[model samples]
Target: MLQLKVIQEVITLILFVVFSLVFFKNETLKWNPIIGMCFLVLAAYFIFKK
Candidate 1:
């Protein structure tokens, strides 16, 4: 279930960001975290690719 874990991680990251943004107005989103999420998405892509 490595694939499952990777997908879960990607979804978790997305939800975490959304939750933080919705619940914490004072906190600002930064480029670094976005970049990290992008990389995680890329990793998920490669793992699922055949």
Candidate 2:
């Protein structure tokens, strides 16, 4: 379970970075809210994780 938590954190972080890059690279991509949401969900998930 602890391993799962760590993995989730890592994955979420990766996703955040990827999304930010994509948003930056593409003007058509509106990633503000999506990035915000990903971070928020990751934070909540980790905070509540055992």
Candidate 3:
């Protein structure tokens, strides 16, 4: 189902972000990637908007 996929993707993204932040302290978070993630979640929202 669309809803299930969205939830899984969001959870995966959060886990990946947390893992990256905790393991890769040398690299600072950037706005572009953050915005890109936001767009991904937003796209999922639109898909479920119907």
Q: Rank the candidates by lDDT, best first.
A: 1, 3, 2
Give the alpha carbon lDDT tens digit for every residue of 1-50 in model 1: 99999989999989999999999989999999999999998999899899
Residue range 1-50, candidate 2, lDDT tens digits: 76667667667766876887787776454688568667767766776678
Q: Model 1: residues >4 Å from true position, as ranges? A: none
Misplaced by over 4 Å in model 2 are 26-50
Question: Each candidate's TM vs. the true structure?
Answer: 0.93, 0.47, 0.72
- lDDT of model 2, residue 9: 66
Best by TM-score: 1
- Clashes (backbone N, CA, C under 3 Å), per candidate, total 0, 0, 0
Let me know the TM-score candidate 1 reaches against the reference structure.
Answer: 0.93
lDDT of 3 at 27: 83
Instruction: Return whichever of 1 and 2 wins on lDDT.
Output: 1
> Which whole-number lDDT from 0 to 100 does residue 22 have in model 2?
80
- Candidate with the larger lDDT of 1 and 3: 1
lDDT of each candidate versus the true structure: 0.95, 0.69, 0.88
